[model samples]
Target: MTKRHQLALATALVAALALGASGCSDTKKGSAGGGAGGVNPAAANDGLTIGGTPAKGGTLTVLSNQDFAHLDPARNWVMPTMDFGTRLLYRTLVTFKAEPGKGGSELVPDLATDLGTPSNGGRTWTFTLKEGLKYEDGTAIKAADIKYNVERSFAPDLTGGPDYAAQYLAGTEGYKGPLQGKHLDSVKTPDDRTIVFELKRPVAEFSATTTLPTFAPVPQAQEKGPLYDARPFSSGPYKIESYDRDKKLVLVRNEHWDPKTDSVRKAYPDKFVVVMGLKGGQIDDRIIAGEGADASTVEWANMRPESAPKVLPKPEIKKRLLAESQGCTTMLNLNNSRAPFNDPKVREAMQYAVDKEAVVTAGGGPALTEVATSYLPPALAGGKQSDPLKIAPAGDPAKAKELLKAAGKEGLKVTFSVSTGDKGRAEAIQQGLARAGVEVVIDTVDPGAYYDVIGDLSTTPDMSLSGWCPDYPSGSTWLPFVFDGRTIKPKGNQGNNSQFRDDATMKRIDEINAMADAKEANQAWRDLDVAIMAKSPSVPLFLERKPLLVGPNIAGAFGHPVWVGQIDYATVGLKDPAKSQG
Candidate 1:
């Protein structure tokens, strides 16, 4: 999934930190549990009680700069929306355990009785629904509901989610979705409780894919087609009480929900009130102040780098912060289909010329970004590989110039598409590339629509700013989703921005995908990552670290490692429940 980036803090704010906050200790060394580069294991547990035992029965306010893009599980691919939808409104077949560090990668049963049992040489899988499972409306959640939602993922209209179903499921080659009145025979419901899946090929990690929202059940009777984005039928602990699009959303307890069946979500708060469209540092400011009802608030957005000077310096305020790995790598995507960049030498020159150190500074310094050389995050299998290019962090413009000269494209000109808040990073790249005689023109899109604009092949530019977080802790989620050419489509191809579809690369992907042994597959993926970097389809910028600010009176808040290091909404509660009544 595309990782959302925070806006660049103003130069004035940063300058203030440098000049006036000289006595303050560096924020990186003072993190509560883990180092800035790692996740706090204490914060990533099932209970996630960072601030002690959570008091229940209060309204927990969630502040965000952006609104929910798509609430429908079929359209849920991005992290914030996925984190909210999966933990609150819906339940998947299986889910990752809410533990910190490596333990967070463990997959556990959710609505299903257990992780699916694979047969047919890992091609066919079966899952039995938990007995007495019910929807928000108090109706029995049948196996057909799970099958229907998985089927809807293939619909041309609902095209933004993960492509695992279309890529692996048998008999999905010619089928669209149930909207067109075609049933996916590959997904069979032998009874109300039993569901079976027939795959196009053997996938040993198929059970991990079930943790995605694509596997969440949506009863065909309640389906609203495209309008399901407005309000999806709740199958979890919370039901949508009211929604006002980009402004606000209110969720109340699903009276029909039974905690006995759910193990991943604690659902401690009585209600959830999400406030959207608060730009810049507004959410951070409110939480830092901790006044009245604000004391019970937690944020969905990252803490602004500008606010770090105020919050990170003081022991009291710093204690309320959560700085952790997002398991994402931001990069500059070089269009493999477009001119100038389609040439490998030109792409390599751009890769060498771009300064990752400057890019990191533009993004908010070392506390928020770790210079990344490999596309694979350190959290996943095989971990991060050493830089194949062997270029310095400041970049090698001289080597870039030589490469450009050899390619006969020394004076190359290309447009770089960046979202609204990424102007500083775009400028940093522009300045860096100019040193190698390549001119970059900055093209900006609205922050919310950035992915849609760049994702469409028709509208995408020669180069763009993009980032990816694995769907789970697997190399399959990293490479195949982003680099595999076979998955690239005419529209909604958000994952494969680089569009590298070489025959050799595609063949290697198939070979690695076929491996059943986890250890062997991971090693193959690491080797393939090095081979792909040789092609220079994209330039790895940095690994992201999210710093979150929590209200003083908010308790049990932590950055969930599985949720792209965002605060786990389901686990957070009010420290003082009575104050929220104000």
Candidate 2:
């Protein structure tokens, strides 16, 4: 289970969901203009703009709702830190190209000179460093540093780090982490510049996985057990000047970093001061007010959902509000382990009874979400309204009634386990299903521990609200987490809340994963999304979006295609137009 980001209801209210999300992708309509594999035309970015000359030499104050805890590059999975902090300082072997606006996030080489070359059917891979790379301290970086940094992350203390290497590297399964002196022999340092990885199996999405700073080089001499998070060494444009725990953080230019050595980052702001510990509402108000330094500040945390109606109508305020898919598909997971839900007809009936628009409205409305029909967000190439049951998001209570009657379970008592915070949406679902004569009972769980309560197969509730944000930009992230029965586990972040353990589905996922080309693999996964949805195991509610607010004096702000919708922190600079002209 990925540790998961939280900010909104449970795991999302604290963190943004769009990691490799879409741009101007369709939000309202499902599967329009010719059927299979067809996506409607792209949507206009809701007041989102990108690409401008960045003026330097001012402090960019970030007004955020959340405080970042992870500092060790390996442990950075949270959105605010991953997008705004670690990504600026820790250069990965590969990173997303900094193209602004729609469809801009493409994987490109960062520390390495090019995308890795795969051999032996992608089981073995190699990356060669570009000449001359230095850390913040001007120490020369070596392949051994990358190997050690990757290997040491397996240490128990480094538990929450990205696990791509552990999952894909050959012969690393049973080995203890670096604390126990367990080296991943599969990762070879044949020379100072070249590093090789021997994988247990062909991992098609390995390049995407490398974008995580988990593969960033760490000097063995500077292993400051727990203190590293506060003052991590910089390999990118910024270096830590000072960090006051949960209070204030200031990032200054890393003198050792040269613009010629890096292509992705703009390194615009002379300094970045991240002010922590403002209530969500307070931060939201400050962004709109734009007072003094607040004019230059941007909140990576989303705007208040309560403010949606107020700010929505005002055209001036609307320009600064960016509402885009954050690469997560929020859905209702129908637990297959339960009795009534175990019946296929019952599951199909439930799927037909769902009113996606109503659910999206209850959750936050179009201001914060796009309705979802398939498991994947529609912004992706394969994501279409290819529900396997052919169930439209618009409720079909008569069809649901017919299905329920055919199943010999007319007027069945269907109990749902939903988040207490989502009572309005649950009631919407309950009301819609009630139209079909299905008695929908709402069992509410605490928002903070909803996944825990519902995820427990022991006390498994009939249905629970859940979501899946891809770890990387691939169908492998979206589909496998929810459908691959083999990946399901108790007390873990299992998106397969339905407890669906299908050997056939797992086999198909494996077959698709084995393919090397991304387009082919993603297309296969997209088709699989439709096939799986046809089964009606889980009902997708909406594609999640965060209505992020941008401040006035901030420049070069655009959503990095992969890091959800966080304004590109590296390129963004603080300079009032009046001041910059002088």
Candidate 3:
């Protein structure tokens, strides 16, 4: 929605905040719940997970309640966007290792021969493409095709895509886009294999930005602009065989892609299929029972809370569930732009009024979540658990009422906007605050459009349910988006949703951003995370462990938190469809 990144999209934290696109929901509808195996042996879910080697062949079905928000490589930035499902069809200059946890540090060459050679005081970066690259259509993948991928992202038509390269690349400042014929002189396609980028400044870690799927190469002839989502040309192991937008998508093997050239994906699944529009309970039940093709199905997010009670208890079901830390922090946005919340005392009172226990129960209890004391989750460096409120993990209503009286808002009425799927969560908050003399009017929207509505400052309720996923693996992703006033926007990846505007805090953020030293940066961000909680702009609710049910039919069922707990698409495959239990 705003400048930041797909990463800024949130990458649905770009359309991954803008990524903040669609989160906290996944595939669904069911009669009952419980996994086929039930006894999951997942270890932090990430730190100790071992899925054993997977066998090849059979279709891997991705069932979802909703459709991907964007597919244009440039426009798709949210965390839960179709990057995971469609990644096998595309290749970026640089990509993350297929590992389930902490993928940011696992940068590896995809199309590029190596990371990137920086010269001219790190202002210029160059990458040489690997030989024998070809699109699904059997055409040689040229460096110009890669260059076009970045250039078209700058087109005004391509709004919501990452502009980091456009903004930072030298000789391109004030360059609007390529639709009107203005091209970035800094990006040079010197040959069929070599691509060079001249930056506006000395950026030591520019290689990280290339890891984004937004940099995925596209052939100019197949470029569909706005309609690219219909079916993008493939450069990876799979190609879109048929696409029905929100309804269904089928991927067949891209015979032209040589497995020897790529190192990450095994390309085991001969076909990948996505069936959307099913409700949560429906999908969970099928997966749990290992019925029909459900054995091949997997959820994009977690098993819905509606199915939580039915699934979390069964010992056998726990075996197939993925309960890993996803570096995501779910928080209640206190819209300071509105009344009651505009008052700091009122915000703090509401924070105290929140019963973490009740909220966590509504969020499927500790089996799938851990109460977050600070906004920083343990997934990031220097993120230690600290309860600033110091009240019980449950909450302190008496203290809250006392604060309410202190603030002269003894009987405040605040409207909370939440997703329809999260109705229990809203009711939980309403009940918690009632004791503190606060009335919460529930406002529920469709889960798919939740962020868009919340981002609109004018229509946004006094309080809203939203979350942040680490774009990369750093506090820089959390602190800046949650507290940095400079990042606040009217719509699209609206960071600082609380409308918090404190000069001292903003200054501290500037200082933190400028700190080049790793230790100093980490400490500065840790300090900032603590300081933000002191303001109580928003309540840090919980850190999530994606308790998704992976069908026994699939061999690699580990959930990848980097993509908002979606399975690592490339690595997962069927164990043995022929010998599968259904």
Best model number under TM-score: 2
**Tens-digit lDDT string for candidate 3 (56-79):** 778878878877776677776766
How much is the lDDT of residue 405 in candidate 3? 91
Q: What is the Cα-based lDDT of residue 113 in candidate 1? A: 95
Query: Comparing candidate 1 with candidate 2, which one achieves the higher lDDT?
Result: 1
- What tens-digit string does per-residue lDDT give for candidate 1 at 176-259? 899978998899999999999999888878888898999999999998988898889999999999999889999999988898
**Could you tell me which residue pairs clash in candidate 1?**
44-100
TM per model? 0.87, 0.91, 0.82
Taking the tens digit of each residue's C-alpha lDDT, what string does model 2 give over 1-582?
A: 343434234223311222112232442333211143422222234325632566767777877655685878777776546776545788888877665544445788888988899999888889999888999999888898889888877777776777777778988877666656567899999998899999988877788778787888888887776677777788888888888887888888888887887887888777778888888778878877776667777785777645544455555665666655576677778878767888888888888888765675555444355566677765454433444455555678899899989999887776788777677778878887888887788988776677777767677777777777776678876787778787676766467888887777889998987887767887898888877876778887766555677677767776665666667776777555443221
Off by over 4 Å in 1: 1-49, 155-159, 179-181, 277-280, 304-306, 337-340, 381-385, 402-415, 437-462, 487-493
Local distance difference test scores for all models = 0.79, 0.71, 0.69
Q: Which ten residues in a row have the lowest lDDT in candidate 1?
A: 27-36
